[model samples]
Target: MGTGVVVRALSGRYELLDPLGQGGMGVVYRAHDRELERTVAVKVLPAQMLRDADFLARFRRKARAAAGLSHPNIATVFDIGEDAQDGEPIPYLVMELVEGETLGDLLRRTPLTPAQAGQIATAVLEALEHSHGRGIVHRDIKPADIMVRFADFADFADSQARVKVMDFGIAKLMSETATRLTSTGMRIGTPAYMSPEQADGRPADARTDLYSTGCVPYEMLTGRPPFTADSPAAMRFQHIYSRPPG
Candidate 1:
């Protein structure tokens, strides 16, 4: 919350180095762990948001959903806590700092070969399968959210590319006992990669993740999303009704 060069310690363990990126819910920083002497990604939710009961509930739910899983293809959540900053408490999550570029960044430069695309899809599916088996449905699956490590591209036995899926901020817990996260008729997820049921504001399950994952390969091969529109409203309509281009 200060100048670019300002260094701050969070929870007295994570030493903030520089800001990485920001999303709707929080700001992400590339930080160092004084305890472990390693680099990590710290997603910090503003202290004010923590004061709101509804937002705080959703934020914790998201973190808990992500923290439940352990897989090579998923970013690891190391720690979570609050840090006092100028008399305010800043809640933060310490996550594995993934190396290499995002799928979106790679695609922007060049399209992937069918074989390469297939490899990436398989890795992502493995992650989905593990999460789905635990009743967690990733509501968002897009190029930007997928990290591909070129260094591991030759490790075909493990995976041609080390693909790690990030950002489960809107993932839905698909069990009857789970809390009803979204309000009635409220929509969540990115329109460009949204599953049909998600776009229609219907209940999503493992199948929802399958449909969204299908979109990844389509874009990898065609160098574009299956459908596009001028506005998010139009995209939602297309996701619900329009067939993808052949």
Candidate 2:
């Protein structure tokens, strides 16, 4: 339960090293795969979340659905399994460990120019376009979810950067089974990056993601979210009605 707890999974084949971070839904860990002899990032759902059968079922379904998405700009999912201890049906996803700073951290040190921001945005957009073509909508697209790695900056007369998107935990697939996975009044996304429709508890579509992405470049350039307010409700109204400053 505490930080740096070693979690063994798959009958003691995988050993988690340390807690990378924790969010509302789950905890991410840096772990080692004994079978593969490599480091991996593991996302483990909390045991308490399993108490809500709907949330548990939906979590597993979403994990499986995300595993099916394969793109160079998207994190690669390696494995999915339940906890080895209690068998409470917690879904843990093994992902390739990326070795670079997150966009959030990068932005804190230096604001991105329009050219740099566009390159990163283009990579995210390509991943979204790929997922959307398969009827998947990523509900979370904040700066923290974007990862950047070293790549060639220019060819001859052009400049580019390699970017990767992580954490597809809240992705929604357009399928009959997906409807049962989501609950009412449970908005699943970061308020700062959520679209107007998403903040209003409406189902998110490709357009919603587009709106969210539109905010990212602005934040990268200005070093602030598009809107700021005292509460999530107020932010929602701003997202729906106000024009962000340039």
Candidate 3:
């Protein structure tokens, strides 16, 4: 492994070209997979977060579980490996390279029409149905986590597009860590769209994702989430107490 803002991993099998995005979980990069001869998305977790032995085992187990999922609307997880930089094992997951802006970015430009919104909702529900049937719950489902796959990257505001759900088991992985969440500096779930049970630190099941499934389409149709707040804690509170706007 190399060092600095851009680096290669797994003995140069994947070359980090540029960063796609960063969040509470990790930084995702647009990368070149030399072995496969195709572009891919690589999520490199913050090195220190997965350093512990027990947590590292859990991370691999969960990643392997997510890899079993296969669906057209679910971003495919291709492989997982560690990039040991200076003996610090930084783990990464290779995913299908989806070329499109996030639904969050698309909505920032304009809200979707009912027709388009319906399409996205249908796809998301189908994706959830498939995952739920397999007993996997996507604890965090929001616009940012949904990729609106482009027929063409140039058409940022396409009226119709397919959606691919990303980060399938990430929230579950965060919660399963042997260490406290404070140690990893990662939020367990996104607040505004989280189910009331999830927001309150209660056990979440398939219904939790269905709750967010409804929330995302509402935001797509209305240009705003069902609830909003000045802080993460406040947003979670609203999900627990305040009724959703009608």
Candidate 4:
């Protein structure tokens, strides 16, 4: 399919408009819901991933787990279904579409002030807290996954920006069933924002997410990731051993 082609969804409830972007595990599309008369973001797994039994099973489980979570700071998952054309049983997650810039995009032009960073950080922290309470750890918590929206046009002086956390595709749930879901030596999550324990291939917990959260504010203030290296391996090493820049 072409980059921006409007493809019909598998369930036929929604029609995908065009490709918004591709992530590690899935391709996100901007789609319109005919029944609801609104726009939604759809994340569809790649064909290759669906063929992998382990990945497909875990993907469904994770999607279900994420769908059960409801929070203002977290993106709302509306529906899950397969593609109708191929009957490949591909799992696609429907999410509320927010018209705002990512934290990464905003940082490219101007670094957030300490107060601004704090505001964003607090919202993410709240999200993590809620997810953690549900026995879920957001393995990836980087600036790129954070969506920032202005509070209001009139209350500019007193308004604080709102933040919505996205992309829980790699989230690990603290349940017995999920123990064997993740593949061995298959490191997930963004390298630059990975926690030390995660970089070392250790099972992550809430603290691991907190460590990743720390990287966000650091990047917001410094205009760069806390760890830097020549390659992914070198970056992993830095994450494991080096102290963050002061």
**Candidate with maximal TM-score:** 3
Worst lDDT window (10 residues) for model 1?
A: 173-182
Q: Cα lDDT for residue 233, model 4? A: 81
Which portions of model 4 show Cα errors greater than 4 Å? 84-87, 151-156, 169-189
Provide the lDDT at 235 for model 4. 92
On a 0 to 100 scale, what is the lDDT of residue 56 in model 3? 70
Tens-digit lDDT track for model 4 on 1-246?
Answer: 224565565477778888887644557888999888999998776554554556656766777788888998998888777664445666677998967778888889676677788888999999999888998788878887899976662454687887899866444432222334345322344589888897888888889889999999999888899988888788989998889878
Which runs of model 1 end up more than 4 angstroms from their true locations?
A: 2-6, 46-48, 152-159, 169-189
* Model 2 stretches with alpha carbons more than 4 Å out: 7-10, 84-89, 151-160, 169-189
The candidate 4 region of ten consecutive residues with least summed lDDT is: 173-182
Q: Rate the local accuracy (lDDT) of all candidates.
A: 0.76, 0.74, 0.80, 0.75
| Alpha-carbon TM-score of each model against the true structure | 0.84, 0.84, 0.89, 0.86
Candidate 3 local lDDT, 74-121, one digit each (tens) = 999998887777777778889998878899999997666677788888
In model 2, pairs of residues that clash are none
By the lDDT metric, which is better: model 1 or model 2?
A: 1
TM-score, candidate 1, is: 0.84
Model 3 vs. true fold: TM = 0.89
Task: Give the per-residue lDDT of model 1 (tens digit) for 221-242.
Answer: 9999999999888998999989
Q: Which stretches of candidate 3 lie over 4 Å from their true place?
A: 1-5, 150-159, 175-189
- How would you encode candidate 2's per-residue C-alpha lDDT over 11-90 as one tens digit per residue? 47668888887755567888889999999988776554455556656766777777888998988788877664554565
